[model samples]
Target: MGWLRGDCVGRGSFATVNLAVCSQFTTPTVVKSSDVFSSSSLKNEKQVLDRLGLCPEIIRCFGDDYTTENGEDFYNLFLEYASGGTLFDQLKNHGGRLPESDVRRYIRSIIRGLAYIHDKGFVHCDIKLQNILVLGNGDVKIADFGLAKRTEEKQSMCECRGTPLSMSPESVNDNEYEPPADVWALGCAVVEMVTGKPAWNVKEGSNIFSLMLRIGLGDELPEVPNELSEAGKDFLSKCFVKDPRKRWTAEMLLKHPFVADNTLSSKTSSPRCHFDFPDWVSAGTASVPCSPESVEWSEWKFDSVRWSNCTSPVDRLRQLVTDKKPNWSESDSWCLVSRHQRTV
Candidate 1:
């Protein structure tokens, strides 16, 4: 499709996400681009999305292509643009914690997506709040599958994958990432949503080796927040089971009372009910060009001003305003400025 890439929206370790306007579509799409030689993760994500097919809780991938710009080859993967940003951003916007009702709705959607992924014989290695994107309608979708892997592949890999805080015990101990690992990550995500803190108690200068030992060899599990309801605590208990063999699967979690009772119909009552469209969409048309390069300053008079002394245009303006202060003593009358009042 013919498209024009706009400003950069996000930057990952290996790729850059930008807004793009396509000729064939009305809504803007996000394009993640990376150097052709370093785009293995992007290619893998595209393949995984294609294999998973259509799911409302999963981010949709459009297509991918290769282009040469500035004599450098780049691989671009097109995906649906999420207007409400990531779940982490949602938490930050709402003073760090989300209402339990909203958390239930989001968790239900995540479980559904996880169940589908598990059934497809894959494990999402990374399942943190940052990887979950919120929609304009207060719904959530799983995104960023760069660390995803097939079930069989996960067993053979010895290196750990995914964020340290969300890593399951088995993943850290044996590098075994399966459906249960995703469930553990889900538990971590839920704790974060309800308590506005990481499931693991990581300190500012904590050693990585010590943290790994605690997760892999220690008997303790992530503390279920006291703020959670009885059913919510039970649900987390099943997820935080140290034994991966005994941990509840995503399919089982869907039937749990904490999330099973909640429905998308409650979205109207959610605190984040208002729409958050992108800045570009809300910015209306301008009569004159708005770019800095298009500005003309030749008409303004700079009387007895040393241009060399002024570092910027703002400094020049400040100097001019200070020099031309109004003489209040010469005025016979003064006008009071008050906030405009509307009449019913």
Candidate 2:
């Protein structure tokens, strides 16, 4: 009955996530954790998904908890499980580039998710291919709200916090940065989508300056293959603009001709179920090997799966299925999932 897969969907400075299956409901879910204290302490992620109003490009948060276990407070969270994995993993596994049209639609999804985040007044500070999740359908979802901050308060530059390669020029130079930075990240992701690697990456033992030379000062934008249509090149040009102020916003990018006029010629497959049981079932708790930094999360502490503000593990969870009030914040769900510890 206990079917959870514990592979890192994504890793932030403070958390890790794994895929899970809620056999009881026959629905796929994700689990995550901060791994500091008890497994019960978690933040539900469903609230974020609900709050964002359903961007198919972003992973949906389903349930979560923040509670005390073993005299320690832990944070656990959960969300929709993506079986297809992340764009980064796909890039490595697919081996050798994506078609320009395919890249366009992928970028469109990235923008749609970002647009939803911006509309909800949040900044997905950590936007990267690793955080871009792919579903059974070709659709993509942005995961990992651990570093996401929901605020209208804008920062003027160096305040950007995340992987540097995808950062905007202003973010890299410590100038005023805003939502536009996300576009830059999207552009980097597009580059990776088409090239099968990061737009800008430093070699082992290389200084930061050298990497910057390839991105900040160099013509890092890959040549739009001669095979690409003019509209595709134009879209990339807009994103690669050096001026952050002039960069496209999520909404603006969505209105681009490449996307607004594009159609999905390749049909999308409907959802298919993925379930394969194991020989061994966990006794009381399913515990997996996690880093000392993650020892707590690697253990199953599911007490705080939901808050009073939401539902409770003690109450008949099935009953809540009748009404629409059953959901949790993204952070909490991650904390909860981290404890289940199933890796497939």
Candidate 3:
């Protein structure tokens, strides 16, 4: 049976992702296509995904083909369709920022995928929320390997790769890319998944040079949202270390307390205890639910928070264990800091 193209679902710099129906296939699949003149990236992505083989945390490549329409040869790649769309879309669905439990689960899947990718000798240079697809089962798979390259491949010391927002400090400053570069991007992606904003208070078309400077030379790291637990912040710390050599790998991050701690165990009887909020911690005037939205946070004291004990992963997925930090400045400007808007 011939392929029947459906509505356009997404448009990218190199290709357009479309929902398609192939009479030979039972389940609907997505087709990412680019004209022959501009097909190198698409071809590269397909080859990389094929080399990766089968991975639960990675979108499956279902082969590729080329078609001539109106004299233009269009190359296409068939991929597993994720009905839940991208993690970025999920963030929007939650009105910016997913729940800690959801973030933990998704991050675990991402770490698994990254680990497998690294083990296979490839580096997914592009690892952002938009590049992560979510299945109908709520499981996430890393996608968009257009920028991926073999770990052993050497490039010019000054050639930068990957999305600017998620580029590692080393990649920005020295053009050094390794498995750790993906870890750095993974950290930035986690921040966006939790806070509904890019790691830095910047966008695609803004002063990229200035952003790179802050990422490369400045001492200031992206401001961690007050909503995250000590473990969550520390997890980010491992990813944001200026030295790529010291950055935590996906395998190591999968074992982090932020992802493994079962404080809010679904199987445990004390589900409310997941918040880990002490009775003394409350809204200045009332007892409100301890959520990212409820905290009247103003200035952030990044240096003062104490970390929680990292625990091993249990059968059940865990939620963040938030503790009261005395350093957060109390102010009415809390509303302004709750969510940072972005253009991308």
Candidate 4:
């Protein structure tokens, strides 16, 4: 890939940094990776995604090719650019927290994505917020196949590789772990999304011993927010459990009451605003993008004045929530307006 520094969105240990590949490629397109990893693992991820059959929720794999600059070959997996940015960005920006409802949303997406992957015989060995990207329209995509491996749907012991912050205790201990390890990381990501801090946020970043000290051992779990719905609390508790066998399944979490149907399941078809959200949703910055045809999106209204002015989260929140009406044109750019729940 002969891309420039401007194409760079991220850098990593093994691959060429996340750089925009196409020149004047304005709309964001994730480059297929040119990185290093075990052959079976990469092959597993490729076959798994291929079995997924072009899912919109998952990033699209453009093509696999060689990196001329690095002189090493790789499977190029390109995907959509989530302009709103990462869940990690949102969590950190707000001092390590977000609304519980929003956390539920992202977690739900994680479950769905994981289910799809697992259904196709693969385990996302690395599941973290940084690997979760968001589109402007509120949907999410799971990235980073470098560590993914094909596996049977059943649970079992598996080795692990990823940041310690999201590592499951079983995986951290180097025991036999399986898909449940990913669920554990998903739980960690969810907690971080709502609290804005890792389960064990301490002073020294390099003090591995110190970080481990914060992570309670077998049968010792962190204190979760009791305010979470019984379903939410129970769901995370199962996910964070020390025993992988005792952990919750991604499918089970998908069906949990908290995530049952929050996507479009509100009693009234009103937009999901942040006015009276609980501590977590009130705190997090993740959002579900509104489709223009969204009847729920059109009817929602808030203080545009506040959105247009202010220095606090209130103002920033209003900006993302604020609906922008597309300007009407006399000569419509390719007009064929068959009404289908118009937002305007």
The candidate maximizing lDDT is 1
lDDT of each: 0.69, 0.54, 0.67, 0.53
Which model is ahead, 3 or 4, in terms of TM-score?
3
TM-score, model 1 to reference? 0.75
TM-score against truth, every candidate:
0.75, 0.63, 0.75, 0.63
For every model shown, the clashing-pair count is 0, 48, 0, 21
lDDT by residue for model 4 over 208-289, one digit each (tens)?
3333334435445554554555556656666766767766677766766667766533232212323212222122322321
User: Least accurate stretch of 10 residues (summed lDDT) in model 4?
Assistant: 299-308
Q: Flag regions of model 1 displaced more than 4 Å.
A: 154-157, 263-344
Record all residue pairs in model 3 with backbone atoms less than 3 Å apart, i.e. clashing: none
lDDT score at residue 65, model 4, on the 0-100 scale: 46
Candidate 4 global lDDT: 0.53
Report per-prediction Cα RMSD to one decimal.
20.4, 17.5, 13.6, 17.7
Tens digits of per-residue lDDT for model 3, 261-342: 6573432221122222222121122221222223331122111011112232110001112233333343111111112211
lDDT of 1 by residue, 1-344 (tens): 67888889887445788997788656558998989887777888999999999999999999999988899999999988888989877887887788999899899999999999999988988888878988788888999887788986733332345666687888766667889999999999998888777676554333344556667875778867777776677777778888888777888778777888754332222112122111111111212211111222111101110112333323322322332322222111111111221100
Which regions of candidate 2 deviate over 4 angstroms? 1-14, 21-26, 37-50, 67-73, 151-160, 175-177, 201-203, 209-228, 263-344
Model 3 alpha-carbon drift over 4 Å, by segment: 203-205, 264-344
